[model samples]
Target: MIGNNISFLKGEGYDFCELKEYEYGEDVKNIDWVISAKMQKPYVKVFHAQKELNIKIVSFLNGSTYFGTKKFKQEVITQIASMLGFICVKQGDPFASYIANETCELCTKKSKKIFNVNFMAEQLFNYDVIGKNIDYEFITNDLFKKIHHKSIIFLIGDFFDIEKLDLKLLSKKHEIFAIIVRDKFEENPSELGNVNFNDPSTNQNFEGVLNSNTIKNYVNKVKENDHKLFSHLQDNAIRFVKIYTHEDATKKLIGLLK
Candidate 1:
């Protein structure tokens, strides 16, 4: 099945050139007559080989001390990252990650120094879960410079605001898999029932009540903001999905890839 997919991609054509010597494995029909005559040697035509669907799991674990009222987002981030990383490794795909503190590393099967899923999980888990700030613009720029090849970047965050990101820069090279993790309390702050709420990042506090209209308004705002973000992804051909902490994340992920 993988070979067939590669063949189909070749038929459709690619942007790069591939070089190969005359070999029995190659299609003899692709032989270059001019090159063979000029060189006075048997030289085969070199067609660009299509790369398989390479998947790279990119996660940003912003625990920030107040991720959720229940399970910590950092914990969830590490677990999911490990799960996906293991899956990709089993599928023979490369894995890479940038934790909240911006510790970046690449995991490859062919590496002399093995960086397996356990190593990735440990790095993600032991990473500082509190007070780690993000500079999305800088991160995006660095990603472009470093990972020049195409890939799927799964970004996990609370998405407290859009200010931290430069989506256009990332969209230029990657198909983003935006995973926004939200808890019921955050989604419906009023559900906490007449209590003080604090901005996890800044530690700013505000008091609010659980009125029907307030809940409705907050839900609509979240939905609208999510719609805008997904619209950006759609416009750029990037894949995006929103998952709630109460929901089954793995199911949603499998559905998205399928």
Candidate 2:
């Protein structure tokens, strides 16, 4: 099934190349109205017969991703990243990755084979998940310098912390698809009598009673944060999807791609 899906995408070069006068055999849906109005003639977008599809996976391995009810967020990240890498390789595209936690590393060279994909996945799996502050500025700066071609970047992370400015800047250069990894516990907390919560990134501890009111507040806060993040991504025209640790990662990803 996966192989069939990859094969399907291989033949469909969806990238737009340039605007040209409409041809009779061309699809009318590709017409650019804004250009047509200005030129007073029907014009359609031309795309390369064989478009270059580059895939880059940015995996955030942080301490917060280690917390999950069923499977760890880190595990989900790895699964999704590996799946994307495989898809890229199957389509004969170059696959690169940026693995970061307290520090960041970029695999700039594109890998066009299954063995290369496996190697990248191994590096992602072996990376330690120590809670470290993410330097979005530094990461984006490095990415801009390294990747010159326009590519599709899958930003996979819990995304508890991110800078809007940094995200906006990166989106301008590449097509960004955000895969938000989340745990059920983080979204909906059970009403436990007394519990201690620890910050995975900072290791700060807080003691509080999880009553009805407290639970409501927690859920609301999560929703608020989610809204802000979603809004930012949407405003920037960045496609995004949420993957929960309790769900099947492969199914979710396949559905998203479809």
Q: Best candidate, TM-score-wise?
A: 2
Q: After superposition, how far is residue 24 of candidate 2 from its true place, in Å?
A: 23
lDDT of 2 by residue, 1-258 (tens): 122222223223454557889978888888899999999999987654454577888888877876888988988898899899888877777778888665568743577778877777777776667666566667777777777888888989988756432577778989898899999888987888898888777788989888999989878878877888898899999888899998988888887687
Worst 10 residues of 2 by lDDT: 1-10
lDDT of 2: 0.78
Provide the overall lDDT of each model, using Cα atoms, as 2-decimal numbers. Answer: 0.63, 0.78
Q: Where does model 2 exceed 4 Å of error?
A: 1-47, 163-165
**TM-scores, each model vs. reference:** 0.70, 0.77
TM-score attained by model 1: 0.70
- Cα displacement (angstroms), candidate 2, residue 76, comes to 0.4
TM-score, prediction 2: 0.77
User: Ten consecutive residues with minimal summed lDDT in candidate 1?
Assistant: 105-114
| lDDT tens per residue, model 1, 1-258 | 233224323432343245346777767776677777777766765434545545556666553534656676666666677777766656555666665434443433322122577787787667654545565666667767767777777777766545556678777777777777667776666554686766555556788787788889988887777677667767878766666666777887787666
